[model samples]
Target: MLVREIMTTRVVSVEPSSTVKDAALLMNRHNIGAVPVVDGGSVRGMLTDRDIVLRCVAENRDASTLKVSDICSHGAVTVSPSQNVSEAINLMATEQVRRLPVVDNGRIVGMLSFADIAREKAGMEIAEAISDISMP
Candidate 1:
C-alpha cells in the first residue's frame, strides 16, 4: 500500500510565527497531538503536545509569548504520498517518530501516523515499529 492510501488528508498546520498557545488550541480543537510548522510553503518544523509541555510549560515560558518555531522539533522527517507504506514505516522506526508529514511537490499534503498504520493491521510490522519508536 502507499502512504497516500492511509495518510490523513485533513491535516492542520501552523505558521512558524504562530503562538504556541494558538497552536496548542488548534491541537485541542482537532484532537490531534501535533501540527506541522510551515513557513513560506515549506515545512520548517513540527510542534507537538510534548514540546509545549516540556519546552514551554515546564520551562515556565509563556506559551502566548513563544512562537511555534521556538519549541517545535526542526528538520522533521517527511514522506511522499507515493512512497510505499513499508518504507514509511521504516522511516518512523529509524527516526523514532510516530508521525510523519506527507509532502507532495514541496507542499504539505497530509500526515502519516501510527493510528493510520494501525488501520492497516500489519501486525508484526506495527509492533516492531512501535517498539523501535518507544526505545529510550
Candidate 2:
C-alpha cells in the first residue's frame, strides 16, 4: 500500500501567522491533535497540541498573542504520497513523529497518522512505531 492510499486527504491546515489559540481551537473543533502549518501551498511546519502545552502554556506565554510559527515544530519531516506505507512508517519511527504531512509536488496533499496506519491492519507495525516515537 502507498501513503496516499491511507492518508487523510481532507487535511485541516493553518497558516504560520495564525495564533496559537486559533490553531488550538481548530484542533479541538476537528478533534485532531495537530495541524500542518502551510504557506503558499508549501508546508512550513506542524503545530501540535503538545507544542501548545509545552512551548506555550509551560512557558507561560499567551496563546492568543503567540503565533503558530513561534511554537510549531519547524522543518517538519514530510512523506511523499507516492511513497510506500512501510517506508513512511519507518520514517515516522526514525523521526519520532506521530504524524507526517503527505506532500505531492511541493504541495500539501494529505496527512498520515498512526491511526491511519493502524486502521490498515498494521497492528504490530503501529505498536512498534508508537514505541519508537514515544522514546525520548
Candidate 3:
C-alpha cells in the first residue's frame, strides 16, 4: 500500500514562526507528538516533542518564547504521498527518524510515523524491525 492509502489525511501543521508553546498546545490538543512547519503551503521543517523537550525545555528556553523554527528539525527528511509503505519505512529507518512529512508539489500533504506504519499492520516482524529503530 502507498503512504496516501494509510497516512492520516487530516494533517496538523504549524507555521515556522509559531511559538513552541503554541505547537505544544496543538500537539496536546490533537494528542500528537510532532507537527510539520509550513510556509506558503511549503514544508520548511518539523517540530517534534523531542525537539521541544530536548532543544527548548532542556536548555531553559521558554516554550512560549521560542519559535518552532528555532528548534524544529530543518532540512527534514520527507517522502512523497504516492510512495509505497516499504519505501517510507526504509526512509524512516535510514534517517533515524520516527516521523516523515509527506510533501506533494512542495506542499505539506500529510505526516507519517514509524508508529503510524506499525499501527497500519499487526505483523510482528515488521513492527519489531521498526520499533527497534524508533526513539521513545
Candidate 4:
C-alpha cells in the first residue's frame, strides 16, 4: 500500500512564527503530539509536545513568548505520498521517528504515523520500528 492510502490527509499545521503556546494548543485541540511548522508554503520544521516540555518548560522559557521555530526540530525527515508502506516503515526505523510528513510538490499534504502502520496489521513492523526508535 502507498503512504497516501493510510496517511491522515487532514493535517493540522502551524506557522514558524506561531507561538509555542499556540502550537501546544493546536496539539491539544487536535489530540495530536506534533505539528508541522510551515512557512511560505513549505514545511520548515516540526514541533512536538516533547519539544515544548523539554526545550521550553524544562529550560524555563516562556512558551507564550517563544516561537515554534525556537523549539521545533528542523530538517525533519519526510516521505512522499506515493511511497510504499514498507518504504515508510524503513524510513521511520532508520530515522527513529514515529511520524513522517508526507510531501508533494514541496508542500505537506499529509502525515503518516506509526499508528497508521499498526492499523494496517503490520504488528511486527511496528514493533521493530519502535525498538529501533527507542534504542540507546
Candidate 5:
C-alpha cells in the first residue's frame, strides 16, 4: 500500500503570512490539528495546534497579529505520494510526527497519518487463519 491509497485529498492550506488566529480558526472549523503553511506556491512550513499554544498563547503573543510563519515549524519533513506506506510510516516514527504532508509535482496534494494506515490495515479481513491471534 502507498500513502496515496488512504491520504486525505482535500487538503486545506494557509499562506505563511496568514495570522495565527486565522489558522487556528480554520483548524477548529475543520477539526484538524495542523495546516500546511505555503508561500509562493511552495510549502514553507507546518503549523500545528501546539504551535499556536506554545509559540503565541503561552508566550503572551497575540495570535491575532502573529503570522503563521513566525510560529510554524519551518522546513517540515514531507512525503511523496508515490512512496510506499512503510516509508511514510518510518519517516513519521523517526520524526515523532503524527501527520505528513504529501507533495506531488511540486504541489501539496494530500496528507497522510499513522492512524490512517493502521485503521486501513486493521479493516482487511484477508484470512481467518493468517496467524495466531496473540502477540509475541
Candidate 6:
C-alpha cells in the first residue's frame, strides 16, 4: 500500500504569515492537532497544538500577534505520496512525528497520521512506531 492510499487528502494548512490564533482555530475546527505551515505551495514548517501551548502560552506570547512561523517547528520532515506504507511508518518513527505531510511536486497534497497506519491493519507496525516516538 502507498501513502496516497491511506493518507487524508483533505489537509488543513496555514500560511507562514497566518496568526497563531488562526492556526489554533483551524485546528479546533478540523479536530486536528497540527497544521503544516505553507508558503507558495511549499511546506515551510509545522505548527502543532503543543507548540502553541509550550512556545506561546507558556512563554506569555500573544497568539493573536504571533505568526505561525514564529512557533512552528522548522525543517518539516515529509513523505512523498508515492512512498510505501512501511517507508512512511519508518520515517515517522525515526522522526518522532505522529503525522507527516505528503508532498508531490513540492506541494503538500495530503497528510498521513498514525491513525491512518492503524487503519491500514498494520497493528504491530503502529505499536513499534509509537514506541519509537515515545522513547526518551
Query: Mind sharing the TM-score for model 6?
Result: 0.89
Which stretches of candidate 4 lie above 4 Å from their native place? Answer: 123-136
Positional deviation of residue 81's Cα in model 3 after best superposition, in angstroms: 1.5
Clashing pairs in 3: none
Q: Which candidate leads in lDDT?
A: 2
- Over 4 Å off, model 5: 124-136
* TM accuracy, model 2: 0.88
Query: What's the C-alpha lDDT at position 125 in model 6?
Result: 72
Summarize candidate 6's per-residue lDDT along 1-136 as a digit string, tens digits.
9999989999899999999998999999877789899998899989998999999999999999999998899989999999999998899999998889999999999999887787576677775776466332
Candidate 1: pairs in clash: none
Compose the digit string of candidate 2's lDDT tens values, residues 1-136: 9999989999999999999999989988888888899999999999888899999999999999999999999998999999999999899999988899999999999999877887685677775776466433
Residue lDDT tens for model 3, 37-133: 8888888888889999999999999988899999999888889999999999888888887888888988888888876788777677777876665
Instruction: Tell me how many residue pairs clash in candidate 2.
Output: 0
Per-residue C-alpha lDDT of model 1 across residues 58-122, encoded as one tens digit per residue: 99999998999999999888999999999998999999988899999998899998867875756
Q: Estimate every model's Cα lDDT from 0 to 1.
A: 0.88, 0.90, 0.86, 0.88, 0.83, 0.89
Model 5: weakest 10-residue lDDT segment is 127-136
Each candidate's TM vs. the true structure?
Answer: 0.88, 0.88, 0.85, 0.88, 0.87, 0.89
lDDT (Cα) of model 2: 0.90
Q: What is the C-alpha RMSD of each candidate to the true structure, in Å?
A: 4.1, 3.9, 3.1, 4.2, 6.7, 4.2
Off by over 4 Å in 6: 122-136
Q: Which residue runs of candidate 1 sit more than 4 Å off their true CA positions? A: 122-136
Give every collision pair in model 6: none
The residue pairs in collision within model 2 are none
lDDT of 4 by residue, 47-95 (tens): 8888999999999999999999989999888999999999999999999
Query: Which runs of model 2 end up more than 4 angstroms from their true locations?
Result: 123-136
